[model samples]
Target: MTRQTGAGAPGSPRVAGAPARLAARFSARLEKWLEAERTQLPLWLPVGGVAGVAAWFWLPAPAAWQGFLLLAAALALPGLVFGRGGRIGRAVALFALAAAIGCGLIWWKAARADGAALPHAVVAAFTARIDRVEPLPARASVRLTLHPLMVAPDPRGGAIALPGRIRLTVPLEDAVAGLAPGATLAARARLVPPPSAAVPGAYDYAAVAWFAGIGATGKALAPVRLIAPAPAGGPSLWLADARIALTAHILSELPPGEGGVAAALATGDMGAVTQDDNNAFRNSGLAHLLSVSGLHLTAAVGATMVLALRLLALWPRLALRAPLLLIAAGCGGVVGIAYTLLTGAEVPTVRSLVAALVVLAGIALGREAMTLRLVATGALVCVLFWPESVAGPSFQLSFAAILSIVALHELPWTRRMFEKREEGHVRRLLREVAALLLTGLVVEAALAPIAIFHFHRAGLYGAAANIVAIPLTTFVIMPAEALALLFDSVGLGAAFWWVTGRALALLLAIAHHVGSLPGAVTFVPTMSRLAFASIMAGGLWLALWRTRARLFGLLPVAIGLVMTLAAHPADIFVTGDGRHLAVRAPDGQVALLRQRTGDYMRDTLSELSGREGDEAIALDDLPGARCGPDSCAATLVRGDRIWHLLATRSPYRIDRPAMEQACAAADIVASDRRLPGWCRPRWLKADAALLAGTGGLAISLVRPAVVTVAAMQGQHPWALHAAARPAGAIHGSYRRFSQADEARHHSRNRWRD
Candidate 1:
């Protein structure tokens, strides 16, 4: 009648065996999941390797020995437990091995790229060979990347050597003096070490430059003297000459705007394209067309293959004697390689080239094509050869777009849409349209997080734009352009050129119309690494996994989205030199500390503050700001606390009484020069010395915290160089130009600068 004893109770035996029961159930489910993912497991090898590369990049100061040790342990793991553990164990070992290899690859690559960085800013006259030239007509400048052959002796009879490649921004007229690759030049330039990130979590151009073997960058003091003409011997020189010639021919055939776009599509030269067109393409999500990646390369290869096959079939003897499909595939492969090389062989183009070649090989061998395995192979090759590329947007976005498309089609439902079936032309057309739309949507969704992470904005209507732009470019413009080039030698390409120009005009019009639509671009605040990592992990899980378990990925993806939405930007943004400062007022509008601001500074601050579209009001214009000749005092109210900020407007010292009173009353003080001992801020003192090491500052009022680029970057080599200025030398400025900007400039010069 009363409570039962332990052994007699109904739940006692079950409780006693719960651990064993749970273990058995878990093992059964694990084994089931492993079997379903057996084929997919190899696909994750690249993911693991990329993760290792990311780990290496993110670590404070990762060492080669660490990578080596990790790799050794991973290789020995399967061997150590051979025939002991089940499928789960083997999978773990495989992933670990892949990650270790990635880490090791980056370390080795970094070691090779390492060189002595410029000590500090110096005005030295040096003779150098032009490795590359970029024409930035928009800025009226030409950027030259050079390998120093000799440096003239210092005025004081001292000597210095430019250890690695250096980039100089020269006046457009000056660049014309010696503006070709492989040409020799002599010029006096104000060279400084590569700058660090402008803001925490912003793109680190310094890291990229370091890996690219560029130790210093500067501006030319005067026009460069042509020491020697471009010597034509090397393959690089030949490619450069050919690319320039081709771009020039296309430009000459077409009108200004259309010609620039055509040249970009044909030869990967975006130099002549106006910024307005660039913006439209970006906003409309048609930006991918401008980038010579999967879509362009695939279309080129496909066109070549089809044309070759048709021409061969015309000769019945050759068709009957040869493996026509293999021949076509071989033709496609050659065209893919040639197109890639002609397009400058950028990271994305190269990645696409490798993938296209793989697909062509599959066609030749009659193997399953357009699968995740093919994508994995392409990714593996990229990570192996250019492991650092895994961290860049080009590699991430290119691979993600392809992976998503392939994965979507791999689904049984989607595969049915592509499989041949008997139907009316209208019905078939509708199905194809729907499939393209679906693919666009899938690609848009897949690329959103990465786009937002790198650019702080994602195209909201990319799918809709791509629906029209893709076919327009692939079928109409590119093919027409190719044919025009082909018949141009016989002077019969005028009509074709006209057709290509018209198609391009339509494409540009579409981009402008779609990009101008409301909410075409969705701007988000700077996302934390953790949140981005979560989204990446979730996306990979969803895309890679085949079973219902993949739905679990939605949890992390949702969480990451929420985290991103909830993230708040810092209240104040300050440049390292204290020449520019921005603050968010109590009214939620950003205010500038100075009356004037550079375009680069303004845009960077806007993006960092998550208000890309908003115009910044000057400090004196704001209600709670008081400004004078030497400094500006502003009030930023967050919740119940009011923060008093005193920012210097000029290098000259302010009035003693005014400075003392401002410092005494202020909660934060920001100046480029050292402050007096008697003047102190309650929260932080961000002066020249402190900012030098930090590179830039993002101040938060809510928690009263400061996040520096140094802290965000940790003790990486690129970051360390910012704090290593030589004695009596001028300090290097914060990031002045992004790699993308430089690349655009270089492209302009690469082809008829």
Candidate 2:
């Protein structure tokens, strides 16, 4: 194996061509394996991530440690690649070492941040420094991370009033830190959730806090109290200034009327973006822009690089590649620092800076870093910095999408597709447009299943909106934004800010219009983990697999088909008795008698055929044929038998003997009764299951099957099926829910409402 050495001597082996030699060392099989790894690596990451999610699903918290381990193995792929020892093996060896250290650090932070059992609220004389500011619409809130100097639980053991935060915004921070790099403040605020319960097995606030280095949360009890004005107010405050700046600048520039959305997209101040704006961004498939991701960083640096290269090329004396490379690296650092300051240095922003640094370093060294290595390095760094982020959506989805892009784009055909095109400014511009659109599409499509399973909604039209707006923003808006920053820094905001805002407004208008276009997005109410597996796997194969074989392309398609088939359709066919909702099963059987009806909320579900719609007649009515859990029930009308029931103001009259027989042989029981302190057989909650074990609404909803039920006597017979898992110490914690009373019951953190 030829080693890449730095020393130059005739006797010394040539080290300059190590990269080429390394590439050549591969056998056809090794080459294929590497290519496959590139393709499969991304696909596997999400698959592994989902698997971790599934393993801990239904449990109270995310298994951050286990999740980190799985991710570590994935990052150590190069070592997994080089099973044998040789000079080339060392490259993979170092990669694995980095991966290990990164994972180890994350594991430690996760444990420290895991204040899962800490009191939610506390009244104490605590001082929480504003770590960063999240941009929001009407007002802005500073993210106050506490040092946990004191912890006093409330006597009530219910609510804890810890501290408060000030409404620090972009302009506000500039006003506060006008002349200093690091400023200081003390505040008392209430830190709580954003008006909804976070999805289980997806994003855990507690886990998120660990990575963010937060122990407790609350909104500011009053305005912030100024503590000091040192450079860092101490080393602690100094550490936070860079992160806060990036988000602050973008917020400062946006028209105050737009709410937090303008700043959110411009920078990574998600706190500033309102929920509605978040929804809009999600629907528009432009949410990535708000995250301060590799895309944004790359765009910033690339623009600077191109300009630097162009300028440097014009200089006859400095035509050597090394100088251009050095200049690019320097420019990248400048832009990244400016960006971080502007966007408010967030975890994502810091990670992105690392990625930008890699790009810069590659240029400075005059060596093209393999895109995968850079991705791996960024990932390793993220792990080292915020290990708990392994369980965060930002970390999981961002890394997954980036790796997918690297993997898919690296496909020879995927690359050749562009290479084959003609060279020219117009051609290049068109290619850029295509690349941006494709990039958005790939990420959206890849993340769609997870988004649906965790939240809900597909944003069907987002791809088109992105395709239209992305090119305009990348070429027109970003450049203007950078130029505006320079002018503003040079005391030209009066001119630059106006020009920049106008250009930004134009881009925003394009996005809004494109997003407003018909069929821009569709909301899918529900989905399952299996569907996530299928979507990403399918997307990877479709983008990466090199085969003329038609069947290969169809593998992922087939997997999706199977998953969709298994998931009951979104439309709920509620039965009179809650235990038996008509769900279109995957086996093509219309078992119109099942109780799990919440599948209606799952946006990803699709009925196999006429199972739900065609047969639905009434609640208390039975059809021509008698069909029960074991046999058929009496008809609601004069007809033979129908799958329908009747709602009554109170308990309804029923043939005691017949009902008793049905109950005796009944495989499930359901009721809408709110009465607690009673136990019943396989209970149901208004046509939904109420059991401690299997076949609950969530499980049944994910895998809808036709279940035949017996009868319902009491009015609102569905109430009779309300089954509470044999009450015990853990009963309240694992209680199942139904849609009927969902609006009324508010679930708090860790347990049901």
Q: After superposition, how far is residue 226 of candidate 1 from its true place, in Å?
A: 0.5
- Over 4 Å off, model 1: 1-17, 63-85, 586-588, 721-753
User: What is the model-wide C-alpha lDDT for candidate 2?
Assistant: 0.48
lDDT of 1 by residue, 337-365 (tens): 88888788887788889988988888788
Model 2, 86-148: lDDT tens per residue? 333433444444544544454344445433323323434344344444434344434433343
Identify the candidate with maximal TM-score. 1
Prediction-by-prediction clash tally: 3, 95
Off by over 4 Å in 2: 1-109, 114-116, 120-130, 133-143, 148-203, 220-254, 257-262, 265-267, 270-276, 310-322, 383-387, 420-443, 489-491, 534-557, 569-753
Candidates' RMSD to native: 8.5, 14.2
